[model samples]
Target: MKQFCSIAEILELYEQYGNEFYSEEITQTSHALQCATLAQESGATDELVVAALLHDVGHLIDLAQHGSDTTAFESDAKHESIGAQSLAKLFSSGVTAPIALHVDAKRWLCATNLLYHDSLSRASAASLILQGGPMTSDEQLRFRSHPQSGFAVKLRNWDDNGKALEPPELNFKKFAPVLERVCLK
Candidate 1:
């Protein structure tokens, strides 16, 4: 529901609320930075790096819309959809599509990889139940057919691995150029 007009505005959103705890161990900003760092370190395209950075932005938007209640996480806030739709206003599908599908990628992984479910953090696993457990056969087929699904899977791996307690050396501002480059303008 938030209209992001520029990369600065999006950055400001992170600056404003990103310090909030994402899980017991990491803040939202730290998680984002770590994810983006992983993407960048792996030589992902700028769009994918930016997507990695901003994937959970919907949680911030939901926090703003709901006024600090924990209820957003209590149910399926659909943060992936919320973030992708909002980012789509200012970014191309290359950036937003991976974000949108990342959640489904998680579900798909859980369905396809027996060991994948064990890799999730407790918070992520709890959220997974709220996100409808794992994908059904039909859902997995649909997820596989999506063009962005592969990127989503990669992003999901980064998402899962990004929850480190140590803050990343690179901060959110470091990704500004990447975000600007991937902007729809």
Candidate 2:
């Protein structure tokens, strides 16, 4: 089995996977940068920001493993879960929790909040009800009870707005220091 990848290794994996999977849209580096910026601006911790930066990483593996054009959103086989699980093995719980719980948070909101359901992607719309069925009695309690619910809420917002743009200062090497600093601590 593959060993737990280091932070730099993870970053490299992200770069390679991103180039392969998102070549049509924004680059993986750009996506991670945007996510990190959003997380930082929103007052997330360093680790959480890192997690946000790598949230969609599972998509890389998903494309390779599932050989599909789109993610299977109607089932529990979500990229977020896959990404979260993958990240958890390498990072701390605080970082992985937001990544892992984001999809569930989206599902939770869709079930309970009428407005949330309409805004989901096509695949998400199909699986909204079955993945705990529109915030049932148990779901409602679970949603509220989750410790990362608030962080998940923020993460969702960032995920929605983390669209790529031409970065103002493409300091490709800037984040390297931050990553090193955090990892070495």
Candidate 3:
């Protein structure tokens, strides 16, 4: 697993890979900044905000090696889990759990709410099938019961909304301090 030794290293990683095109119109950095901004605007805790910022870090790592292979996005690379594991050393579950579960939360929302599934963008809607489509009733139950599911849902919503907005002027430096403050170390 990749481990960031300092906030600067994470920022450097963002500098290096944040501009990659995500699923649709947004770049990876744009999506992350937008998600973090949304989380902060929604009164999320610092850890949750950091989680929002770093939630897609795995994609940075993955795409570095994989080079935007269609097969990658077409299949479930488990980016959520990959990101959570990579950041687990510096952050608590408050941060990592949401990073781990945002995709599952999307699945949960799809199974439980027709409006939500309908709200999905063309790319997101397409990726849904690859990301395991909707959850079963049993899966939804488990998701609801999970300790961090609420926050994960919040992040998931931001995740969807983030892709639609224009990228902001804010960059990794603006977020580095928040991440540093929330780190377990």
Top TM-score: which candidate number?
A: 1
lDDT of 2: 0.66
Candidate 3: where is the Cα deviation over 4 Å? 70-72
lDDT of 2 by residue, 18-51 (tens): 5552334566567667777888887878877777
TM-score of each: 0.96, 0.75, 0.94
User: Which regions of candidate 2 fall more than 4 Å away from where they truly are?
Assistant: 1-3, 20-29, 64-76, 121-133, 164-173
The CA lDDT at 82 in model 3 is 86
User: Per the 3 Å backbone cut-off, how many clashing residue pairs does candidate 3 have?
Assistant: 0
Clashes of each: 0, 1, 0
Best by lDDT: 1
In the range 42-93, model 3's lDDT, one tens digit per residue, is 9989998999999999889887767776434777788898889888888899
Of the pair 1 and 3, which is ahead by lDDT? 1
> What residue pairs are clashing in model 1?
none
lDDT of 1: 0.88
Report how far residue 76 has shifted in candidate 2, in Å. 5.1
